[model samples]
Target: MKNKKRARSYPVVQVLSKTVYLAIPVIILFIVVSWFSFSEIRKQNNLAVENTVNIYQTELGHRLSAITHFIQWTVVHDPILDGFVRENHMGDYRNASNELRLRVSDMQYSTGDEYQYFFYWDEKDIFFNASEIKVDYDTYKEIKEKIRSDVKSKEDPTGSFSWKPFSFGGKEFLYYMITYRHRTFACLVSMEDILSPLYSLNLGENGSISAISPDGEVFYKTKEGPAGIISSVYNRQLFPASKSLLPFSLAIDSRVLGNYGKLFVLQVIVFLAALMLSFIMAGYILVSYKKVILPIKMFSKSLSEMDSVSDGEGLDLTDSKIQELNQINEQFKNLIHEITRLRIDIYEAELDKNKFMIHFLQQQIKPHFYLNCLTTVDSMVSLGDIDAAKKMLMFTSKYFRYLFQVDMNTVPLINEVQHVEDYLSIQNMRLSRSTLYEADIPSECNSMEIPPLLLITFIENSVKHAVPPEGESLKIWIKCRMMNHNAMEIIICDNGQGFSRDVLTKIRNGEDMEEDGNHIGITNCIKRLGLLYDNNFKLLTENNKPRGAKITLRIPVNDK
Candidate 1:
């Protein structure tokens, strides 16, 4: 016969496969998101560069216009210019030019510029004098020719002016001039000073400004060399002296193009890194689902199988693939053992209830029997059988009253001590033994709550088991006091034969006593103390110093 092949079972493998299937969509989503983020960053960077260029252009244009307006105002308002024109003298013109030059230099310092020079032309003498002590002869000649030409042609001279190839102190300047109606003065401010306002405007580290004349002459430039010049552009035709001015054309710096390229490369690198991290995260989740989730699922399955087993039936859940599942299976077995323990506890509770009912019924019968017997004995004592009837009546009524008075369970220490005295009184009447019972219970501990029947049981046990022999008087002492700020302790001691070592050990360890059924009362009291106070109570039993037994019960005060 051919052997049949068994089907393979691997929960981890199955879980891993499912996780990989789920990760496909997540990986695709991460890639799409990264791509969009990269694209948006690039777009935003381009817009930033464009906006920077636009702002610089607008600010440069405004600065250039302000410089031109200042020069026009100086020519029209200066006292020196008016004085020189009224006198029409070359010396007066020289003095006036020198004074104006000093004033203009001080103004230049405040305006954040290198120089501000003024020039004057007399139409009558055909003479020209500039504000500076030394003038560029070539620049002076060029301006003289332009003014003479305008005069000969009888053209309108009160308008905006421009000069190209104008040399000043061996350096070139693109001169911008404005003519006045009554005074013929040409203001010559360097193009460098005209755009110098850009430096003080604080355009930030990455921006530049430039000022250009109508004739394509660069007045000033920020940044040096080719980078500065190449960055600024001027349109001569659009800004001619004969034509209306046009707005400056603005554009992104060519150097910023390289920056954008570098940024694009960086963005590409970031996108690739993000993609790799996303893949790594997906792999980690898949591995976790396989390694952790699958094992837990197997453990859960084993528990379900174990739960289906009947009582006393064992389950085999030793799977070699998952050690954690094996441990869970072992825990399930322990749970089964715990269930057996619970069943035993239920049985014991029922037995205890039945025993309590029997005890309660026996107690009820003792009272009725004692009352009837006591009545007959009292009557006989009255009719001359006094000693016999008195002894019988005392013994019967004392014990009977104790057994029947269920309301005396949680009586105060003082009251419990009085009850003990009453029992001793009945015992003295019955026997030839004379025993003294003294109680010293603190008044402060009187109101502290204690379980009912606890003290009575201990007192009864002491009296019944520790009666003195003939001719020896028995002495019992009971004392209660606050042992500490939070605890109350009661000590009961007697001058009777103490218990053996074996009996003391058994009582301390809560072992059942085999000698008498009356030990049940002490056992019940111990159980009640444990249930009521838990860890807040202590009971100790020991032999007194010379002879007798001492029992002490310590209970924590209820602050509530």
Candidate 2:
């Protein structure tokens, strides 16, 4: 009869098994596709940023070079500049300077360059060819001095020049100076000519350009101030001795990348929605299989085997075509076999429980010894020395309190630290020696959780095994900090005799040693860690340099 039922149940199990195997590959394919898509998107985004930088850099370089070339042409060909220089009359020079300044300003206005629209020339103490405005003589002298120094030391005469602050029009200017020399002319061209080209060139929405003369004077700038640029030039080392090109950087107030970020956010929303839909469909399929399909299929197949059941013969449906359903039917037959085995297991489990109870009873002897020690403490309280008795009572209370607080398997790191402090306070009293405990815990991780008693146990062990002899002080240092976004580390180190080789070996192998009373605490700690966190919590015991011990516990931030 049992064999007949077993044969009848085989096909259903086989069918379910085959379906699971097929589903695994389908799930893997989905995950692979999603990962590849995300990776490709990220790569494209980075490439876009690099391309934008390169485009702006090239455009700015071309515009600047063109402006310099135009200035060289103007200085060589302009008849007004020639007339002013040859005549050397102040009135003629002033008229020529005004006219030339007007021309430069008109050119700038026509080209829509709003950064700069003025030109100036300084010879001795007089300013010439300025934009119809008289510049301060002292300001021009300062500008001239800076320009002269830069030109005299320049290794590359034709290159675009940058300068520090030099005076112009009573205000400081960071200017770019270009000197032009022809057969009959030698003159300096301020960065006024480039303002038109700079304004016309596209540098994205937030990008800017500031041209600085070799004398640290401002010649032309798309931005308002040179403080940011001055800081950059002074602090950052410039590369390539020939042409210096600073890449166009995105502005802090830019709204351009907001659109791209929004697109990425939209993609995330869609991906999550698709994943939720897939989970819902998968859950529905699983529910249908468990509630309606499997049972109905089993009942239908069982009806076909009624004839074989009545004939008192063993049926053979194990070879049915549906392999998974057949295996499930076989499992039903095996369940009866499992029931008989379970009876034998129950008997074995009872014997094992008895043995464990015996072991537990034997371990109760240690607590009995602790209780007797407490009685002695009570007697001491009855005597005159209340302080000594109070110390003993406090230590006993803390030791038992920690052991009894089993409800708190995990606690906030701050609570664990408090427990350590309580333990240390009692230990310090018991030893009657000054023990320094330095705690530097970051505020961010104060509320982060960790396994209870994990850190305190190590600290207690250090106080127990590493405290120096009479008349000597002990120091225990502790620091609790977050390693990154999702992990916190506790470092507890002491300065006393370090652990011996034999003790270190015992800890590594998870062995409990009977030689030292201190070993019991460490062993219990290891066991508790195993039960609470499995293999996730790490406890390391090592020797400190020269002498002493360092015990570090690293727990995952979200493990609890």
Candidate 3:
């Protein structure tokens, strides 16, 4: 037979093809999603930075305006500064300084300074600090001159100055100057005031904001460089990073970009999704193999186990998870039941055929043996040996009666043995007691059920083959014994030349008799044994040590 292309033992056991197709689309979708997400992240991040800067700038400007309005309120409400603006005495300046200290000293910590006041009278070219004699000595020379020029050149007497160092009483002050009426007053200020709002912005890890004065001085900057130099993409995009083009610009930190690595996040999401998909696909394949392929394989294996000749049973249907497979299993079970019934019918037909063949062979042998026996009886009667003739005629009549009445398939062991004894009696009488036949069957084994003519064929073969020695009578032993609980053994041995080598080979090979049918008795015995015992019964023959044939049959016994 030609070997065709082999099929997979199990298709689900092979690699699934959907992985690449699923992965490619998943990757593409992830890329598109990540691109949009990154764009939004940058936009939102820039918007957040812009909002931070805007809020801080607005707060600073409002605080400064509040401070200006507060100063005007004090000038109108306090009599000390009013007295100093009305009177030109060192006594009034001292009172004004005392009032300034009382009003501003409690707020010094928020501004990074001690409460020190300095007032300059522009008309007199005179300045009075909190200590009129101490601060009036030296450090006010530059600010006093600038105030004079500013009071003459400006339209309004109200003015202000940026922070400057004024060394008075060996103490440096970051001073601011402002004019109220004709008196220019200077106060100390610092970056700590702006820092309160600056720090409040959410600068997050590497974020920074800068507040630069219009004069290009860095009033407050959390970091050194500009935001553009930090990230290459920062240069291409612009934001309201500088709020109002005034105080400061805010930038989200670039160095600690871990929080916004959206690409990495997208990759992780895609990886997890793909991993989950793979597990789902694997589970699907496993389900298919279990519910579909595995059941088919199991059915195939069960079919392999069946036999048409010897198997008289049906296969059991396996279970399945799918409903279709369950239906298939049900159909298979029904088919197997039908097959089993057919096999049983075939078995019964063969059994009936064997029984018929046995009956036909029995008929052929019975008439021949009976004819010879009647002829012997007639000769004996003619020779006036009336007693010998009666014995022969009576034994022959008894054997024929037993044979015609008994069941051919099975008979009691004792009855068959009695039948054998009756036949041997006729043979010994005819031969004048030339044969010595021994039947060693026990009473317990006598009721065992065996084939009706089982012992007769063996005995007939022995009678035909045995040739008595020159001086000794031929000895035959038909021994029956209970071998075990389930069976009995019968041994028929004779002192005769055993089978020839060719005949023994044919018997061992289990061949049927040839056309001439030499030793047909032995062949018929073997056929009956096969019909009744199948291969379970033992039928062995061997040459005995003293030149005889030993035939041992182990057959199942029935007591009832």
Task: Point to the candidate with the largest lDDT.
Answer: 3
For candidate 1, report its TM-score.
0.34
Clashes of each: 1, 44, 0
Give the per-residue lDDT digits (tens) of candidate 3, residues 1-560: 22322222333223345445655776777677667666766666656555665676576556544445445555446565665654467776666667766665544444324334456666655665532222443546654565566567867676554444343335433455567677666554344444555565444444555444444444454555334445543322222324342333333343222245665776687677677767867876785675467767876776677664233444554543333444554576577679879999999989887776666456535666778898899899999999999888899888888877765578888888888889888888877656787788778987888987778887887788766556878788989889888899999998888777777777888886666667777776787677677767888878888788888989887796
* lDDT, each prediction: 0.59, 0.57, 0.64
- TM-score order, best first, reads 2, 3, 1
Per TM-score, the best of the predicted structures is: 2
Task: Provide C-alpha RMSD values for all models, in order.
Answer: 26.7, 12.7, 36.2
lDDT of 2 at 457: 61
Question: For residues 1-560, what per-residue lDDT tens digits would candidate 2 score against the true structure?
Answer: 96665445334545556557656755676676556555555454445544553565566556545544455566667776664454477787677766766666665563334223233343433433333323456755565565556655666655554323334554434345554331111222333432333344333344445544444443455655224534332111112213435312222111122234546665675577567657756875795575447666765787577555633243444433345544555565566468769999988976765564344334423565466657667667777778878777776676657646634446777777777786666555554476889899988888887766667667767776785645667888998788888878888888888788888889888899766665677777676666556577788888988778887878777633
Error of 3 at 59 (Å): 91
Worst 10 residues of 3 by lDDT: 1-10
Give the better candidate number (1 or 3) by TM-score. 3
Q: What is the lDDT of residue 24 in candidate 2?
A: 73
Total backbone clashes of candidate 2, pairs 3 or more residues apart or in separate chains: 44
For candidate 1, the per-residue lDDT at 458 reads 73
